[model samples]
Target chain A: MMRWTLKSLGTQIASTLASAGGVAGAFLFVLFLEAVFLGESKQIVAYIEHMEPDIWVMQHGVSNMHMASSFVWDWKLDAVVEMDGVEKVTSILYVNTMVRAGDRDWFTYVVGLVEGDKRAGPWAMKSGSASPGPGEIVIPALFAESSGAGLGSSVSVADKKFTVVGLSLGTFSMANSVAFVSFGDLVNILSAGGTVSYGLVDLEPGSDAAAMARRIEAEVEKVSALPHPEFVRNDFNMAMRMGVDVVAFMRVIGSALAVAIIAFTALVQVSRRRRELAIAKALGVTNRSIYFSVVLQTVLITTAGYAVALALALGVAPMISLFVPEVTLLVSTGSLLRMGAVALVVAVIAAMVPAYMVNQVDPLTAFQG
Target chain B: MASSKLIRADGVSKHFGTGHTQVRAVDGVSLKIGYGELVLIMGPSGSGKTTLLSMLGGLLRPTQGRIEVAGTEITVMKEAELPDVRARLVGFVFQSFNLMEALTVEENILFPAQLIPGGIAAARPRARELIERLNLRERRDSLPKTLSGGEKQRVAIARALINEPPLILADEPTGNLDSRTGQEVMMILFDITRDENRSVVLVTHDPRVEEIADRILWLEDGKLRDRKSEDHSWVRDPVCGMRIDEWTAVHTWERSDSKYVFCSARCKERFVEAPDQYVNA
Candidate 1:
């Protein structure tokens, strides 16, 4: 049996590895792109970790806080700050803006962090100072690199210029670079009578986020507060649901291509071994054995292909990160096993018809040619 | 033929297709091949030589006859038991040298052993011995595609012999080879039959094959026409054992008032040594 398996291994290498490598290469690239999208979302969540907010208050009917409108009176923050178990309450005003540095402009998001609120400040600083005063701003390192701007340089946003006091590391949202400034500066730019887009509430230790969220929703309904956490979660869920649509489309396309490739592989393998299969039958090898041999070959080939694809993903992960920062191609052993199981199923599905053809081959035809 | 014959075919018939379109490939053929005999079935194309061989080897179930191989009635055996009978009692050599291209020569030779009941360990030494005897040890590691026509046939022969089957069935075994290589292959096959006390039933369109057979069963139009024993003066063409009629043969030599006929000069030269051995009293 070992000898048979070893011979089968050699047959797989000689016949299927080249084509499998090509297919695996294409699959690796697509998987890498998907990993980048997931990694980007993860990085966005990591960037805002210091806020430590138990509940986020956003506008009603808003789909995503980053891409929707949310405005509440400035007085709402004071009301939230007085709520029991609420350690602190701060408002964040964020909007998309085009920032100009050295005669070139790049699109970015301008986020307003309240002064003296350490919970909402830039999490990591690569250079300069994180303490941006009124009229000063913190820009992401990617923006600094692309714009060729440095410390003390001035960046113009909404026809107003601000000094770049600090450089923040790895702060990006959906591929857009971000800039941070004081809440007062943001209020002045928006010209909205000091109304804020969102209220960030930091809860006391041991407070349940879900419980606080329900209380906050009730309070907001009584006072008609604009931004609510339940609504925010609903909006987050909706936007993520859209992201799921895109993921599903990607999966469909990947699966279709994988099926075609595997089918072609099975076809070629069966055609090549038709004579051998006939001879086997002539020599009293059972139809079941012939079927198994072809199926086994398909399984072995697809498994090797999937393994090569995983290795390619791991090999190119760091290189991909170099081009698209914060994007890491991560495949756990569980993921590998899942992919292998999927490939095996795909292989069997692909090999079924061809294996039947092998079983039907007339042993007497072996005498003809 | 005795009831204990190694192979017995009683009223065997094979038909292809359905109803009006049916073609009788083998029609009502009954014959017996005894133990330790070299029998040749000779016929033209479409004469059911191969069809008969298929039934005799248990590769095909005759549509209407009781066939027995090694005392086991194959017509009554289930499909699952066919492989067991084939592995235990019958070995087949195909005309086209159907060696697995992916496997090495040695691997192809040992394929039958791998398919048998026991592990390949029992067949390894025999395979090695056959390989060395056939002068294929040097090319054992080479793939079938790389070997010459003769070497490929030798590999197929060794594969057929690996299981030590009692009955050897070969269908036009030398049809694809040149005369010289075919002679070498025939010698090896005949040597195997003589040394192992095995029975050989070879089907061929080539008349030369009849010379080496102890008996020749002539098939024509899906039926057996004659079973004739040839005189020893007919030199068995080493390429294929076709018995040439000494009176009308083109290649012939006289010895002791009897003329020995050959299909080719090569066989005549091969028979020159110990001519008395091939001559009838």
Candidate 2:
């Protein structure tokens, strides 16, 4: 039987892997951008959802927590507790601002609540407690290290100084660190009295959280309430939506880059076999049949590149977090698949130019001495 | 169309461009070849030898008139249908020993079998037979690049015969080989023609091959003519006394407005180093 493929099986595999290396470079660039851009939302959503509150009530007209602020009077908590399905209500003062520690400043999401409250406390800690005493603060260990402060060290938030009593993990992201301080201390810092940023509600057994949410919104004059999953989804979408236009624009740019890479590789591969292709054409191999092999090679290259990109992205995230602790990468399955689809599109488009070149090839070229 | 005839061209013409830039590559040429005939098409450079061969083999569509290979009028066939016709009935051999670089001798021989019914597997016995018949049994597993010139041409002939094509169109089949190897390749082609009853249409400028051809068609200025029985203008190299077909000669030098053609680059170089001696001779 005729050997219809590459010189040998090893040559075909080596060619795919070698071409994938070039394709993988393009995948890596786009994946890295996604990690840096959406990394914060990934960490923040994970941190919040881990607390697992039944419902959250923001100040009136606020649908999400990221990049937005809300204020609810402390009396709103009173009104919520009196509702039909009310179990308990807890409050936290939230602010997104830069915290100055010594001479350096780091942007942070500051959460202020009573001591021993887990409703909006650090989900994980490296040292000390989530319940920082009044006049004390809990900062992500990563942020603390960068600020050159650790447990028992002094730090300042919103220009008010507090002793660092706890170091947290899973609270540091690419954009900002989540820092905690006492509710009264935050109130003193903000100089606002008798009001909190948001109210967290827990449902009693057999209570419909969504219905309770609707009731809270209806009874309370100035408030927006949402179920736990809904709140988490909203915050994730909003936080990640910060530079969405850029994300969309980068997606186009990245896709174009991938197309060019694959196209260039396909073109080079086809060009090397000009004589062979012409011979095949003269020998009665239809252009369509030839394209089957070309496209197969391109798709293999693209898929192999995706596998390489996934490995590199996953492998690099932890290394990056280890070396540069401030930056975390979120290589989600959804986005990876999206990029993979883009790779497929790139593979198809890449095959076109070379395939056209093949179509234009004069089979008479085989006769060229 | 006649069943006894393997190829018949009815006033076929191929023009390159329209209007002033037009090149009348083959202008209204007509011919017929019976089965088991070995005909040679010889011409000067740009004489449309390849173009005519391309049309006859269905590798090209004539701009005017018709070409019939076996019983089918190929010129009128749809573009997509021509490839199957060519694969089923026509086999091609080239001067470059156009064996696929990536394919082994046996693999190259069986390359066209993919288009036939039952595919390459069905043609394996024929491939082995051709390999043994062409004296390539030991080299069946060797790639074209690893083979000598004569071996490559033998592989090309074996490949041409693998599909059992009734007509073989060879463009300068022996142009790149030394005289001895060229004669060996020509012998194989003649053997295929006589023994298998296949017709061979070959285009070449090598005058040394004229002795073996059953009939010779001389092409010049885009049309066949009976001006000279000699295939093409033949010139002998002063350095080696080897005759070179001046039309397709790649090793040539122009001095004092006179051209010198050599059979090989070394002879050309020797002449170039001392042009006066050869010119005087």
Candidate 3:
């Protein structure tokens, strides 16, 4: 029933906030990197993977689509469609190029969709239909805002002009974006009349994708087959590998900042108020009780700080998108939990030095004549 | 009967360090303090008065011999258990008015109740009574920094009595106050002995408190000594070599378990500035 008033409560609150701010800064930095690196890869995989394909057949020696190029002879599709359990084969021409809209340009992965096919095309459209006929294009919904181009606008790819017939959804990220165009236009742009970029194959219901992919690789020449899930994983890793070390280093720096702030605050708390601790000890409060209170306060403050950091990140992302429409901050719960774990670590380490200093307080030294 | 005594010490001695550098701070002093007695332990600066008080209150264990408070042997108890004993059997008041600066007067008064039964909630009525009784009701919501020295000491006294400990140990309770305020505090402490029917042991060099005390224990060179009223002699401060009339000297000062008289504030300040230089010389 005793009301406890800590003189350092204000300092503790400030320190907790500062530490949490450091952690949140780290989280945002990671999100930005993921948006640039992993975020783009995620879009790349989602574009192809969401077509409900069981296997991806690309040119040999090419494993992913984030940075690699792939091509197979047009004759390879005949053999793939003839294989057992081959429900359907949708061939799409994929190329990474810059699309020019008016004066602005963006690095775009242009997926050339075939006529009368839904697979490997924009899954959802903000306007118009999912398919783009020859001389027509469909860009990700956010790209329209970034490029200042919308439906009915003309955009150029590979120096070839095409009308934007539709705006696609779930195909945009800060890293890169996807644009759908007519198959023949891309083939004309590439001037390769007898080749296909990727052959998306769907399997019969209840068929094994990995086994079918293996059968395709063994039976076909100059073409590699990969299970859909494995291809997505490979592409994600390939994209993130460039920024992985930097993201990790930034995380370390952020955690260090949090640790430094919390530790220093606790140190100041004890050094400045040691006599108060001694006075309490003199009045018969046990060392255990005093220490328990110190540690408990630190943990509570650090936890509150982490919550503040999460709110800050979630709150700031949308505000940023207002100015930079193409920028998507991938603030995941997994990353927040990682920082929360770091905050907990900071709280424990911060409490030790002060608690130890408090242990040295002699009540007899508190009296002065 | 032994049961009537609030505190009893048997040949207790406290020594610091060892060999050539060893210092005997409290040298085998034996004493008894009875219930409801206001006992004043007066001594020169280095006479072990604080050390003796520490031992009696269970703040420090005697190096030799044993101490019993409220009939419980404390010197033999383990170091870890001393705090509980001190909290339950003793209340401490210090010269600095060591109140937590952030807590209001009422909260400060109830701070020690955490170690006692019923905690702060149960001690609220008693805390209110103490605040009203000590004339601190007006400053009940004020922090220590906002209160005057007199008020701070009153809050400390109230804090000391919150747990209703049978014994109150005060080390230089008036050392930080002006003479008038010091006298006022001494009167309040004197009242606590009668009003609470408890024992109050105060360590001070203030000659003003001699009349208010039931018994006076004078210590010198870590040992308690007996004196006769006619044995007065003109003395120079051993440290400063300044002659002063014991009755009228304003520079009478306590340091390092010994007391001295200086001719001027300069001498007292010089002595305090660096005692080792003067005492060693």
Candidate 4:
């Protein structure tokens, strides 16, 4: 009969720490990527989606907001507003330009909207003003911090100097920072008078968005209409097609490495304790009991690693703001649960190899002198 | 006086391998060890003493014949059932004092008891008693590696007797101990036989244990030989009137019933001359 205890606690802790560090570190990387992806995806369509618009009327061939430019005469806004199931219409503009703050120049995504329009604006403003007035701009916190431009600081865009009157957090499209500008100022800056990028249409409640988009397409000549959600998905797919899928592939690799680390640790622990297992089996202990003990040991070690990783994720997640201050690293309950489920599954899978090894250990080895 | 037999082996044999490479580790052997008796099987290395003991304890299955341990034909039992038989009826002690390095002295002793029904609660008090009786109370919390050789053997003995099984099998239990410590351990085993009236069977080549054994069974070349030889001297040759060294004798006569070793070829020839006259006489 053999009594089992933590005779090798040091070894167990070392193994657990190694695997936990790997899993938690990979999870943190995945978290940062997720934050960036989410932040960018939201920012790309944030102006359109937050407008509560059911349908969008863009140039006939324009596919997304970032890479494509669609222009309609200012009179189209009034025309789309008169369509059936149409509640209201707003004019919006998109422009990509370089903004100079001191010696640093940043490629920026600019959104121009009508003043006092609640349908489209900086949704979350961490500090400073939300809506920019004429000759004033609201920049995302990430751009302002990175370029050392704060509230009241001036930046030159398109050879025109504008004052930074406000800051918005988590408002960026991929690597391009966002700045809200007045539509009147945008027309003066771009010199494209009486023309807008797209016309946003809000549908009455209970209006079928797909049906309304089709009706709007019929009524508006040389323009295509789409549901706001469908347009965002199209935009996201376009981003994915343009190499954002690499992040997904890296996530898969990170998960596999986490499982591998746990499995390798369990395997080594079982090999080192084979003799102890043999002794336990020889002492009238059933094979199943010995197998269960090995499984339990693996799960305990893996769980310890998971706990350490979880604590690390909590501690390091918030610090991602230091790097990309516009994108807040989200550690939601759903994401934590997902990580835990993955850790448990990896732990179980890792225990299986060692459990099989325990079954093969001969009890007679204990008798060998 | 006739006592009930605790272990009954009828023509049991264990063989390994097949064809020309086959090895008969335990040849056909039949014997009975009675209740409360202490029997020692003495043999040189590779004589199949441990294999026979293992078969009696249900650890290794016999290739031929049947073995009854406490009235159960354990040789015919299924693989899964053997552990239960061993846990309930047989206790084993090894030469290496195989105490678990991770467990404290008391926990090692209580391990077997915990496997039985109502064992968990009963184990604690029983372990405490044994620790006190073995004078191990002070060192009860220490791990195996920290204990001295004698202390380790004492803990092993306590563990073996923890379940209070009817039959105890010890394989060279004192092989690693010094002469004085060896005798002390042997004496303790002998005392166990007397105090509990438990049948104890030990396999050892240590001569110090002979005085404590009620009977000694001899084994050679995987076969059982004569029993209870007081002096390691002459074995009578069935062929001619002669005394020969059983250890060094080369000439031998093998019959269907028994084997006889002879000192000379002349004696073997004489036996072959008239088989019945010498063999049956």
Candidate 1 per-residue lDDT, tens place, A241-330, comes to 546677557655665566677777777776766776677878878888777777776676677777788887777777867886634444
Off by over 4 Å in 2: A1-19, A116-119, B16-23, B226-281
Q: Write the per-residue lDDT of candidate 2 for residues A1-369, one digit (tens) a residue.
A: 124554522345655566788788878888888877778777766656766889999888888777778888989888998888788898889888888776778878888977777777887889998898889998888888876888888887766788998899888775667889989888888877899888888889999999989999898987899999998899889877886777778888877877777787778778877788888889888888888767776786788888898999999888987897677777788789899889988889888879888787788999887
lDDT per residue (tens digit) for residues B1-281 in model 2: 24667788888889999999999999988888999999988777789999999999888889998888899989889889988988899999988888887778888999999988878989999998988899998998887889998899899888888889999999887777766677788888888888998999998766666777788887877888763645356788777677777765756788888888876555677788998887788
TM-score of 2: 0.89
User: By the DockQ metric, which is better: model 1 or model 4?
Assistant: 1
lDDT against true structure, model 1: 0.73
Each model's number of backbone clashes?
11, 0, 11, 0
Best model per TM-score: 2
Tens-place lDDT per residue, model 3, A69-89, is: 888998898799999899999
Can you tell me the CAPRI class of model 2? Answer: medium
User: What is the fraction of true interface contacts found in candidate 2?
Assistant: 0.68
Compute the lDDT of residue B256 as modeled in candidate 3: 69
> What is the two-chain DockQ of model 4?
0.27
Best by lDDT: 2
TM-score of chain B of each: 0.80, 0.88, 0.84, 0.81
